[model samples]
Target chain A: MNRNRWLLLPLLLTLLFGFSLSLGSVRIPFGQILTILAGGDATEPVWADIVWNFRLTKALTCLLAGGGLALAGLQMQTLFRNALAGPDVLGLSAGASLAVALIFMGQAAGIRLLYEPSPWTTALVASGGCFAVVVIMLAIAQRLRDNVSLLLVGMMISAAVSSFVGILQFVSKAEEMQIYIVWTFGSLGSLNWPEIAVLTATLAAGTFLAIRSAKALNAWLLGQHYAQSLGVPIKRSRMIIILSTCILTGGVTAFCGPIGFVGLAVPHLVKLLIRTSDHKILIPASMAGGAALMLFCDVLAQLPGSTQVLPINAVTALIGAPVVIWVILRHPRMLP
Target chain B: MSPDTPTIALQTHALSTGYNNPVLHLLENMSLTLHAGELVCLMGPNGVGKSTLMRTLAGLQRPLAGSVTLEGGPGMPPEHQVAVVLTEKIAGVNMTVYELVTFGRYPYLDWNMRLREEDKKIIGQAISQTRIHGFTHKKLYELSDGQLQLVMIARALAQDTAVILLDEPTAHLDLNNRVEIMKLLQRLARETGKAILVATHELDLALQTADILWVAGKDKTLLTGLPEDLVLQGTLDEIFQLKGYDLKTGQIYHTAFRNKTVALHGEGYLYRWTRNALERNGYNIAASTPTDVTLTIEPGDRPAWQLRRGTATNLYYSLGELLKALPK
Candidate 1:
């Protein structure tokens, strides 16, 4: 079952990715997409720009953000032994959004910048917010003995950060508010080359760490005590899991503006389809599942043959929520 | 014929264990020994730190003061040397029985996590030892409590430890499964030559099955002895506060005596059972002192009970009819 589905995931990811590249308001032909991807001139010269500059970058962004967030969610669910735990559960995304909001609001309202800010500066500042939350969470994690309480504390932190973001939203000008609001809506087409490369590096590092801890993660399913008995160094493995999750979610939230649903929904969806809790199998499967789901949602977000594009966050929650609910209801063990 | 000298597998030297944060001491300065190839049951009242003691012995928690040693080394034993089965249930997991049993080899596995042919053989032996081969492919969520307990035991066996500590492995199991697991533990101890320590509340089962009994009471001490010796010395009774039940005669607790005393006369198995029936119905079976009523059991292919009340006498073929004829 795993072998067949393992092949199915990458296949789905590839198909959805290229299929999404061919879709848009102009609706480029599949042959033109192949020709443009193969470094040849398309029948229509404008097709290459739309494909390479807009659709191609957007598709790759979806893959990285989706796959990275999905793995983070999987790690959180296993670390906390919770069905609902995700990247957002720990408030890393919330933290990033809060920092981004503050940076946006401060620039226009008398908190002048010391230097010229690049597009990459936003990603870095957003990560500073994530690092702050991760530090505070790691400190609390040390004092707390169990995962259930840790999840509750994470939720509370998210709530507090959200309220802070709410305050920033309230006392802002129309233009500043629109910038923050559009960032919150989660865009995938905003990235240039350097941003994508940085996102790729973070995703690769996070994935590597996740794979290294796969053995410990499998033991974690038996729970902490049992995992300890099985010779899993509890503290070190715990630190690694949290760090990996933070890096993965932090990178995505910084670059993609807190895209919702893929992190929370993809692992459960993968587990439902793949039928194994072994992290050795689960991590890669979640990676593929997440990337495929994101590209599919991105295609829908494009709203083909229409000029207007829907928010990636809206398309994700609207599509991912019902599908997750259906999967959880049909196969109840998916949550656990 | 020579008598074999048993080797001690695990021992505690004046060990004191409790939580460190609050400076709470549960068991203080307690020394205990567990011999190899023995099934020892640690029986205690609730809140008397049986679990705390178990955790300390298994090295799950640190001892407050003194040390617990395995093979004369004072520290936590090697994971392969001391296997522990906690009371925590593995719930809603998609792991197969075989996969979990093989997980017992976790201590030996490196980052690769690939099991060798030898590890597979050990896992197979564990499954066969606990008789969980039938469900080797089944998911954990599909197993019953009895099956899951057996799987847990198999995992411990696969650990191939010198000592195995289980905290109430038979809890929430049916009577048949309880007996089956206890008997299996006894067999495993003898076969594997591992010291098995079970901390449980099943007094009756422990008394019947354990090679030695470790009874802990409110005084923070473990009184260890043979099962019969513990019962005879009144340690079990003292520890449990056996008020209504008689541990010596195996009598069930009954509230009503009703002041009705009968001199029951019989021999062997028939005599004990007749007394049980009479005693169960609020009738005191006197040993020697005679009352106006006397009941004698006539043992044969079809036994009969002869009941006498002063000059009036009645004979019933069965104890049931004789019980029915008694005055309410």
Candidate 2:
């Protein structure tokens, strides 16, 4: 069972990666996709662009975003020791959305803006917003000393930011409102190379920090006092967790919009499947699980054999919400 | 303090420990020492800074004033010497006993938390010593509260610290489990020669098992001595005596005013339980034969009690009916 648990994730992830590469709007044959991946030309040149450019990038983006967000969710869950804790639950995504809403809606309303509406500007603005929320949450975590209260405070910040965003949308231009709405729906296909580079770098740094803090996270499973008693530097560990979760979810939401539910549900699914809380295994397993699930979700969002693609965020929630509910029902004792 | 043991595992000097935001103080000017090979039980009323003191001593919380030091050589870390087993639910942690015990090696492991041969040997010894080797492969969630408590102790043992502190280790266990756990702690202390301090309300178990007692008193003071010494000095009663409970005798003192009197006779466990039942039912126990009602306990396979009231005799198998038949 242990060996199978270890192999199951990477195996599924590889299979899903292959499926994501081969099955999209223009279904490239599996052989051609492999051939194209190996530097050989396909029967049609469009197949190469479809498979290599669009499908391959989308798959990689899904992998990174999914893996990063899941790891962030795992850290949040462990940090708070709350079963329901997720990256977005702390209002970071709301902060990013608020930033995106401000720029997109500001442009639509013909308001004077300091910078042009570009991906880099949006990424920077989103990161700034994410950083702001993370700072507030960290401050609250220090003072509150209770996870539930901190969670509620996060919700309040999210609600407050969302209300402001509502105001921005109410007075915005129709075209700009449409742009903000589309961003909120989220997409994985729009990122070119530079945005992916930014995301990849952030993902690497965040995962590194998280993996380094695995021992501390395990200690935290017994609560903060137990962790501190075990020689874990509580304040330092909290800082690293906050910083890593911010960089990860912030970077992803910057590019893919607040891609929902993947962060919330993926970690729980991994834990349920693997049945271990050791972050040494959990961290990497969750990464792989998140990647596979996100690729699968991306495939669903693509609406195989159809031109009409659904919102990535909608697909995640549509799938994620039920799994969360089922997990809660099945493992009621695990929930606080 | 023992004359032969020169080294103190943990000591707190003039320490004031509490949360300061609201200016509430729990313990003040407390000085105590835990020596090697001694099992010490800390007793106090609820909300009496027992947990706080334990936390402060374990270095989980900073003291408001004064200092806590492990009496090893300089530059040795406090965590390297002290390990704590908290009562807090390890809740939702999905790991086997072996896995949970492995975390005890965390302080000694590298940043990657890879266990070396020495760590594994220590972990194995902890499991066996705690007598949890039978269920080493069992998930913690599957263990009963008593077993879980033992596993936490095992985890602490795995830390290989000189001092082990536990907060209410027997709080949620049954009578047999509680006594068993207390016995285990006592044996571990003597066997490993580690100083073990257990903060608990199990007065009976503490009286039986503790080599010394740390009593949190009413006046922001701490009383430390042998359990018998504390009892003789009335320090245990001063801290643990509640409205209707006596810590020294391990008996429930009934304050209920009874207008009736009953003289209980016979010997052994049956006589003791009969007296308990009579006291619980608002009957004043008399030193000699009563005016009318006299309860005689007879011990046997199907033992019965005879209640004689002015020559009107009644035989009852259970204490319940005998008490019910009493004159109101």
Candidate 3:
């Protein structure tokens, strides 16, 4: 079954990615998309500009957001042993949003220290925020012991950060608030090459770490004691899992607004489709599943013939929420 | 074959294991040796630190004081010398029986986690030894408790260590399953020449199957000897400190003796049970024949009981009515 799925995935991904690039407000032809992709001039200058500069970047953004979030979610689920666990649920995304919000509000208030930060500065700050949350979570996990309690604590931390962002929204002016609100809506069409480069690097690093930890994660499925008996150094594996999750989620959230549903829903969706929990298979499978789902959702967000694009988060929630619900109702014991 | 004389697979020198939170010390100054080719049972009451000692021995937790040493060769590491099977269930493990057991070779696997032919052979040997080769492809959730326990034992076996430690391997099993698992472990120990240390609450099974008994004795001490020797030396009784059960005869004593007395005359198992019924009904059983009242069992095609109270004889078919009619 997995072999069949593996054969089908690339074709599906290509078809969806093609659909994403083709059916926008401008409605570029498939032939022209191929021409532009192959470095030739399209029939029209406008088509090339839209296809190469805008649609291609947006499509790649969707892939990165999808794959990175899904892998991060898989790592979090295995690490915490909770099916409901995800990048957003653990407040890592909220941490990134908090960092971005602080900068937006700081820039709006004319703060000299941060004074009109660049996209790179924003990404770094977001990573710092994510790193801080992971550290706090690790500390709490050390003392807390129970996975459910730790998840609850993560939810509480997210709530606390959300309120802080709420305060920032209240204090900011109309223009700055609009920018932040639009960011919170999550957009794929706005990623430039520089931002994509940063996202790519972070994704590559996080994916490397995740794949390396696959064996340890497999041992972890039995749980910590049994994993330890198998010679998995518990503390080190945990640290690596958390680090990878933070980099993946934080990097993406810094570029795209906190895209929901992909992280929490994709792993379960893949597991449901494939029926295996081996992380060696899961990490890559999640990447493919994540990328496919994101592109599909991004196309839905585009609405094809319509001019206005839906918020990626909204489209994902419309689909991802039901998948999560299905997972919960169908496999109640999946979560610890 | 004394424990000290035999080749030691694992040993502890004055080991004291406990938690630091409340500054509570459980076992202190405990020195013991676990010998190869022997099945040892660590028996104690609940909260007597059996798990603590097991974890300490397995190197899962640091002992409060003292040291645990494995008799490994110069090149062999401690992890290669010992393997542990914990009571913690492998929850949500989405792997086949084969994959689960193959994890036992983790210490020897390379960074790529590619199993060699030798590793596969060891895994196959482990599966066959634990008799779980029939379900090598089946998921863990599909197995029963007994089968899962065997799979875990197979995992430890695949580690190919000199010593194996299990925390309640027979727990959550029925009588027959418990006996089967115990016998399997005993066979593995003897055949493979690996020391097997099992911490369990099943006293009867332990006493019946274990080659040696390591009783966590009263007041933070240790007792190690043969199972019969421990039983004869009263160490089992001291360690368990059970109130109603007699360690020597393996009989339960009803502590609440009534003022009334009864003399029962019967033979064999029937006599034993009749006395038990009378005793449970608050009758002080007289060893010699009594004059006031006496109960007699007449066994035949229709078994009956007769109660004689000053020649006013009453015959009852069942002991229940006989006990009920005895002027309460």
True-structure RMSD, every candidate: 2.6, 3.3, 3.7
Candidate 1 has what TM-score? 0.94
Candidates 1 and 2, the one with greater DockQ: 2
lDDT of 2 at A38: 92
Cα lDDT tens digits, model 1, B152-267, are: 99998898888999999999999999999999999999998899999999888998999999888857777889999989888788889887889997777765567888888899
What interface RMSD does every candidate have? Answer: 2.0, 1.8, 2.1
Docking class of 3: acceptable
Model 3 clash pairs are none
Return the candidate ranking by lDDT, descending: 2, 1, 3
Model 2: residues >4 Å from true position, as ranges? A108-111, A114-116, A139-147, A331-336, B1-6, B246-249, B253-328
- What is the per-residue lDDT of model 2 for residues A150-263, given as tens digits with 9 covering 90 to 100? 789989999999998998999988888898899899899888777788899989999999989999888888888888888898888888987899999999999888998888
Worst 10 residues of 1 chain A by lDDT: A109-118
The candidate maximizing lDDT is: 2
CAPRI tier for the interface of model 1: medium
What TM-score results for chain B in every one of the models? 0.92, 0.86, 0.82
Query: Model 3, stretches more than 4 Å misplaced?
Result: A1-8, A39-41, A107-120, A134-156, A330-336, B1-4, B73-75, B254-328
Task: State residue B65's C-alpha deviation in candidate 1, in Å.
Answer: 1.4
Instruction: Write model 3 residue lDDT over A144-223, tens digit each, in one string.
Output: 64456877888999999999899888878887778677778888888888889889998999999998898888888777
Residue B123's lDDT within candidate 1 is 95
